[model samples]
Target: MQRQPIAEAVREDIVNGKELVFVDFDHTLLACNSSELFIAACKPSWLVACIDLVVRRLIPWKLTHVPHWYRLRDYACCALIVLLCPWNVMLWKRGAPDLFRRHESRELAVSLRACDPTRLVIVSFGLQWIIRALLSESSWRDTPLVATPNLAGPAYFSSGKLDIVRAHYPDEVIARAACISDSLDDQDILHAVGKGVLIEPQGDVYRAEEHLYLPLRYTAAAKYARSYVLDQFLFVDVLIVIAATSFGFSTLWQACLFVPPLMLSLMCVYELGYFENDMVAARKEVAPTLTAKVERYRTYPIGFGAWAWALVLGLLGVLLGWHFGALRSETLLVSAACWLAVLAVVRAVFFAYNGTATRWRAFFYPVLQLLKYGSPFVLILASLPGAVLVLSQIMLMWCSYLIYRAGGNNKAFNRDVLRLMMFGLGGVCLAASFRSAPVEGFFPYAITAAWACARVFKAPIMRACKTLRSRPARRSETAL
Candidate 1:
């Protein structure tokens, strides 16, 4: 016998007084996109995947928002999906179950449990096969699914969803239905429905109970103050200060007295810069859709309280600096003047860095890094060897950041290479330290080398131990 149509079946269920509820799958029910998860699960080369992500996912996604570009974007997305279908099919079958369990939106999942099974329907612009594979053993497995069927044509999206749903149900049925989605693209269907539930990000998880209306305004209160404070705790800057003081001053007691207040003032100023940078980023946001606007609002929520706290902290830093003889002409005046000048220049560079175009940001980043690493030099009257040691450390840090950003297919290989580089830098510092003063040069180099080794090896050693512990459990499971 032939199977009944999906819309006909769904309409039959809705006829029994249960209002139809159409829920989006990706980003609404799950914390991430299903297609991206599938790509990751395929275990392709990292570089290839990164490139694919930018070209296929990011570019097409951005293009979809441009006027009159929807068709082109859809065609491009569909073509890329078709090209990757074979690989996706081969991998998703094995990985879907695990991916579903790991990435399901817990808050949404809880809310969904209270939803009437008969009234609920899973609708997605993602591949039907992939979604089906993911939900094979899930609670929603038997629920009606309205998804893009095959590589037949462009995926149903925006108003297309409304048209597809209308094919299944009459105008009256649609008039009384509800749509739960994260994207503003679903606004057409949402307006047609009786109720609209919007999914929103709350810290680490997603919540979807908020009633969605067009022209969504910024409403979330400042919740990221603690996060901002934590971000400003620049321990590396403190280390640089300590290294400079130890080498420049006659006694270690001077470092003890000077480092704290100096660091406080520096961190406070840096945090103000961070706030400015955040504001700049917020201003540059292109949020055409209500959903995009809401997300962007949440990301850069108005937080004058944070600004106030930063100012207070900065005042406290200044007070502490004054109390610690930071204002004293003999101990801190010349150094402070020099440090202030450097700080002024760096802060100006930071402003320029924020204002510069995206392509030019890379050029400014290294200069900012140098300011961060080399500013401590003003605290000390440094010899050539001591300066070389500091410069060497700065280069090491800059190179490490670049390596991390330029991720490759083999992460382990990249990590090993970074470790070797760290060791080599440490050895160079150790040799240079022998030629300089004992207290200033030797001690700073020793501390720098030790810190580098500790930081580099800590994560890998922890991972190795974790793997070793897990091996026994895996072996036992295999035997069973």
Candidate 2:
């Protein structure tokens, strides 16, 4: 007794008057390497530095498992902080240079699509222009698209998303659909009619009555909704339980007993920051499929070193307590006043820089980009002794990730001030983590110094790349 083949089953289902709605995009309709397109689009910018990071940091492809319905909810639950931050990927497009499109334009434009024998519907919540442009340019124009119509106004991604799908495709007999989407927003599609395909490359062997799937595919709309996909409500239940248990057992003082929480926070921030940055670059399409590898993990033995030093100050408090000194001793009072003044001045200057300048434009702009971006560590530094730094880091990581994601298909970033920003932040965090007072004082000044050094080094790297690109391509002798 041998088993029947899968394709035969699919053909059988289709031939029996089952209206096959090949109702997903990305990996389903258009077949191209999205990750390859993403990286190619983002090339040649200083963001290439992040590429530099990924090249160095890429975990073996073996370990990067594709999260399906079950795992996505687990990941999303842990990413609660990342999700709460505001994202504005829309801005990256405005700032992008036109040259970005030159190298990274679509491969199989709409003209190349084969006619869909089955009814193909592209369900989406992204801007109509974006989907339209991609479709118009691709051979997929003949395929019907059932997305939230924004020919009207700004519709919430969540509000009418399900309604649009429901109104169009009602039952399995009316439409036998094969959903090739990674996000659970299409769980309606999964539950309603037929098979749900995961575009991601790795996952468990999933089974259902009519459903089948592949790995996750990176579509603009699907990527946005990926977390909400599947039986996620149950996963949420598990997370709430974890939160309750962590809260019940872990007091503020006991929080310092181990490194898992802080290390995890740092890992989350590190990944989310680069994730957003890549998304910003790849906003024209989906976010780039790459990671920024940082070696700062090696150097960062003492995160919140400033706070640790403050604890030593508390030891001074203990000595004073033993001697029965007043809480406001003259010497101690003066040190506290000076510390307060330094904090106010630093914060004011940071705000000013963020409001006005880039990291390098007339010196002040570089400072501004630094302060605006690096203000997380500033607040973290200011709110020492408590766990406010962890929360601040969480907020910045999530916010930065969103801003990075909102950019359009283009991945070009203006390199001047933000160039100053990368090292500026790294410098601040490095500084804050140093325990010595002199080292801490020296850290703030390093942002300016690092900006100058980066500007100088950037030129040589460009010259080398130009020389390489200028070399002529070698053609095969068979052509001659």
Residue-level lDDT of model 1, residues 1-480, one tens digit each, is 122222322332333446888888887776677655554444333333434445554674654563435434433443454475556566667778777888777776766666678888888776678788888777888888887666534335434578777767898988888777776767778778876655562124332111111010122212244333333233345554554445433434565555555555444345445545655543653431122323433443223333333334334434444455443334434544555675567668877877876545667777877776565455444334335445655665566555544552333444434644755665666567666545444665555455445656766887999899887654555574
Candidate topping TM-score: 1
Clashing pairs in 1: 247-440
| Residue 103, candidate 1: C-alpha displacement in angstroms | 32
Clashes of each: 1, 41
Candidate 1 regions exceeding 4 Å error are: 1-235, 247-261, 271-344, 380-390, 400-441, 464-480
Using Cα atoms with residue i matched to residue i, what is each candidate's TM-score against the true structure?
Answer: 0.39, 0.27
For the record, the alpha-carbon RMSD of candidate 2 to the native fold, in angstroms, is 21.5
Off by over 4 Å in 2: 1-18, 30-118, 151-156, 159-162, 171-175, 199-480
